[model samples]
Structures are given as C-alpha cells and as structure tokens.
Target: MTFEAELRKGNFQVAECTNCKKTVWPPSDFCNQCFKEIHWRKCANEGKIIEFSKQNNYYFCLVEFENTIKVIGKISSGIPNKDQHVRIKRCGMTDDNYFFEFSLI
Candidate 1:
C-alpha cells in the first residue's frame, strides 16, 4: 500500500531508494539523489525528541526517526526532555495533515 493509505491505517512508513539505500523524506515515488525507484517500509517506532514546546496543557515536540524523518507530534503523557526517547503511540491523517501522538519510552 501507498504511504498515505498506510498512514491512514495508523502505520508509519518510509520511502527508501532501492539503489542507493538512502531514505527519502517526504515520501516520494522516486529518490531525490539518484532518481531511482523507492520502496516502502515500516519506520522505526521509536524516535528521539529534538525539541519540544508546551501549549496549554499539552506538549508538542519535533521528533526524529531513523535519524532522517522528523515529524511534529504531541506527547501522550508526562513531561518531555531533550533527546529523550519516545515511541509512536498513535498516528494517522487529520484532514490534510498528519497527526502523531508519542509516549516516553
């Protein structure tokens, strides 16, 4: 299945270049570097919190997965710290944007 299709099912997938073995961010059908075809694979569930901010009662953070894909998601519970490890608790499309919820690992 495609990226959007899989994401809609709460499965996070990444696009990787088959020839160069490099991950392509933003999920493309073709690799940006070699212009080769891409293959879809499940992304690592765990990520490191790059940065975070508190809004109202919730904490939102920028998390990096596989050292390549960075996404903004909300903390499911507890206060987050820099470079803290987190796991994807929930993810799916929200209207036109993607939404992710993370929990400390």
Candidate 2:
C-alpha cells in the first residue's frame, strides 16, 4: 500500500534518509538532500502550528514536525490558534478518500 493509504489508516510514519539521518516529509522515493534511497519510519504525531488560514470552514495549517517535516492538515470544529501544539486527532478515509484532521492540545 502507498504512504497515503497507510497514513489514512492512522499509521503515523515518515521517510528517513539512511545516509544523512534526516527525516523527510511527503514521502518520496529518494532522499531530498543526498538523492539516496529513503525508507519509511514511524514519526511522533506532535507538532506546532507555525502558520494557518481558514477557508471554506476549515482551518488549514502548516504543521512543523520534528523541526524538519511540514505537513498540511485541516482542523475542524474548534478555534485553532497560531503556534498551538496539536496532535493527530485521527486519520482515515473520508468517503473512501484520504483525509487528515488534527486536534489542538
């Protein structure tokens, strides 16, 4: 299965560069830094919202995880503040489509 499938199944994971020892976000086939092979690994769900914006009733956030990986997740049903520490409330397929949602903590 693809990374999106795994993550949608509530599997918190990311790619790590074996050579550089750096974590990669938006999982790729090769390392962004060294152009080497990358492997999947588990990642902490905790992150800080560095920036955010609301559109169409959803707060979109640029969450920085482990200070290296930044991902966009939607926040629903709560007032989310900037720089707020958040966690993955849950991940799954919405209407059989991949979806990500977070909860402010």
Candidate 3:
C-alpha cells in the first residue's frame, strides 16, 4: 500500500518545517535545526535508517524520514535491513503501537 492509503486508514497527521523546508513526524511545532514554527505536510512515509542500535530493553533506529527529517523509534521483530522499503516499527511503552521506519536492505 502507498503512504496516502495508510493515512486514510490511520488518523496520524503529517508534519513539516516552514523555515527550513523539512518534514517531520509525530508532529512537531518547532524545527529541530532552526527552531522555527514548523509547517505541516503529508509525508511520503519513505526514508532510510541512518543509524540503529540495541540498548538493553529497547531497540532503537534513527530513521531519516523522507531524506530530510530524522527521527528515532523502536524496532519490530524482523531481521535488520531485510526490507528496504517502509516497514512498521513497534512503539509505545508497552510495545503495542507500530509506526513506519525504513531499512537499508
């Protein structure tokens, strides 16, 4: 399925930066780099895993969303980089929710 299709099924909103022209997830009002009032735009849900690590009780991946915005999230049950495309990563304190994250493949 495409990113737009996922948006239709889900209720999450897309985010971007007005000053720096960057896209962000989890909807931030301030740009991480410029610290300006950010804008909101529909994301492509396409990105790359720039960095990843396992720290005790958590698996973290620093995903560069849309080749512009980088965000970190927990990894799901799968071999790392097996899928280059956008895949779901488990989130939340109890590890129930799954959000999009890309791999190098």
Candidate 4:
C-alpha cells in the first residue's frame, strides 16, 4: 500500500526493493538502486529528532529513523529539541495528504 494508506490505517511503512534489498523512504513506486518494483514494509516507528522548528502553533521536526528514513512531522504534545527520541503517537491524512505527528520520548 501507499504511505497515505498506511497512515490512514494508523500504521507506518517504507518502500523496499525486492530485487536489490534496498529500503526507500518517502515511499516511491520504484527503487533507486536497481529500478525494480518496490513494496511497502512496516517501519519501526522509532526515530530521533534531527532538527526542529517552532511555528505559530506547532513544532515541526525532522525525524531520522534507521535506514536513513527522514520524516518531517509535527510534535504532538509539546516542543522537542534536536537529537531527541520520539515515537509515533498517531498518524492520519488531512484533506491535503498524509501527516505524521509524534510525541517526545
């Protein structure tokens, strides 16, 4: 399934190439390594905040997971700092697209 579909189901996934065994984040239709068809795989849902910024009402964070999966999400509860560990609280899609919101650990 697509990333949006995974988020809609309250789960997270990444694309992996069956041929090359390469993992792809930000889910893509094809693999970059071997140009093979990609399949979605469940993610660990654990990451560390690489960078973050506070906006008007939200804290936007760039969370880096294992295998170099970097997802940009908003902090669910409160502010988070760089290198802070976080976990997925919930994920959903708005009218626009799938959004990942996390909580600091």
Candidate 5:
C-alpha cells in the first residue's frame, strides 16, 4: 500500500528498500541510497520521544520510530518527557499537512 494512502486512513506505514533492506524515511517509492524499489509495510505503533515542548497547554514532541522515521506529534494527554514511549492515538492529513496525536505508553 502507498504511504500517503494508508496514512490518510490512519494507518502508519514505512517504506523499506527491497534490495538494501534499509528503511526509508519520508516515504518514497525508491530507496535513497541504492535507488532500489521500496516495499510498504506497517510501522511500529510505539515510538520514543526524542524531544518535547509545551505550547500553551498542549505538548508537542518529536518521536522516532524504528530508529529511522521521525515525526512531530501532539501529546493527547498527560505530561510528556524525553525518551518516554508513546503510541499513535490518531494520524491523518489535515488540509495539506500531516497531523499526529500520541498517548504516553
């Protein structure tokens, strides 16, 4: 399945190179390194918070998944801390931009 298509349906997906077996970030049709075809698969539901900040009452964090994909998402509830594990609460396209919400695990 295509990354954007699955993402729009609230299913997170990652692309891996068929030849190099390397994960591709930014969801491409081909691997950036070896230029091989990519295969799409479901990404890990859980990720680690790399960094976080509060804007007003909402917390936003940079989360890393499978040690490759990094996405910025908002904390759905509770306070967030660095290195905390989080799971995807919601994800979809909003307007032309991607939006993600996470809950602390």
Candidate 6:
C-alpha cells in the first residue's frame, strides 16, 4: 500500500545513475538530473534518515542511502532528530517500520 512497503517487498524497484552518480529511489529509465539514460543497481533494505516533516497526522522522513540516494519514508515510532544520528528501523509488519531524522540506541 505504501511506497516503503512496496520497496521492501520487492514490488517496487529503484535505480541509480553510474554516470552522473545520482540515485533514483522510485526507479526511472532516464536520469532526471543529467537527462541521460540511467544505469541502475538493486538496493539493500537499509538507509539513513536525513530529514523529516509532519503533516495532518502523517510523518514523513527523507532517507539517504550509501550511494547518496534519498527516499522518503514514514516514522512508525520514536522521536525525530533527538539522537543526533540518522537511522531507519525496519519492522516485520513493514507498516511498523520507522524512519527518523536522527539515530537511535
């Protein structure tokens, strides 16, 4: 149902550019940054949250991967930006996973 769930289940795939060195979280054939054909790789289910926003009872987090790829996800639990480290927590339910703008112990 959610984009993060889709990605975790492998229903949704992402792509990154090896040329201009950009990552496309939703996966695209063309690089939006360089306007070039994209060469992509599969991502492991891990990333760090760099930013977050709350709206209308919904929390959104911006997740950054190793290749500088950024994806937005939801925070199912914990306080944002309190730990000073960017981290994402994956739960078994997929829906329960929380992405935070800071790390947690």
Residue 21 in candidate 5 has what lDDT? 94
List ranges where model 4 is wrong by over 4 Å. none
Ranking by TM-score: 1, 5, 4, 2, 3, 6
Cα-based lDDT at residue 79, candidate 6: 59
- In angstroms, give how far residue 65 of model 5 lies from its true place: 0.6
Candidate closest to the true structure, highest lDDT:
1
Tens-digit per-residue lDDT, 1-105, candidate 3: 222343445523456678777665455667677778875555545556666777785557776656655556666554445224444332222233435433333
- The regions of model 5 sitting more than 4 angstroms off are none
The candidate 4 region of ten consecutive residues with least summed lDDT is: 1-10
lDDT of 4 by residue, 1-60 (tens): 577777788888888899998887658889987899988888888899999998988899
The TM-score that candidate 1 achieves is 0.97
lDDT, residue 92, model 5: 92
Candidate 1 residue-wise lDDT, 1-105, digit = tens = 488889999999999999999999988999999999999999999999999999999999999999999999999999999999999999999987899999998
Candidate lDDT scores, in order, read: 0.96, 0.80, 0.53, 0.85, 0.93, 0.56
Return the clash pairs for model 5, or none: none
Whole-model lDDT for model 2 versus the true structure? 0.80
**TM accuracy, model 2:** 0.79
Query: How large is the C-alpha RMSD of every model relative to the true structure?
Result: 1.0, 2.4, 6.8, 1.6, 1.2, 6.1
Worst lDDT window (10 residues) for model 3? Answer: 88-97
Off by over 4 Å in 6: 1-9, 16-26, 30-40, 82-105
**Clashes by residue pair, model 4:** none
Clashing pairs for predicted structure model 1, backbone only: none
Clashing pairs in 3: none
Candidate 5 matches the true fold with a TM-score of 0.96
What TM-score, computed on C-alpha atoms, does each candidate reach? 0.97, 0.79, 0.47, 0.87, 0.96, 0.46
Per-residue lDDT tens digits for candidate 6, residues 30-57, read: 7778877776455545665577788777
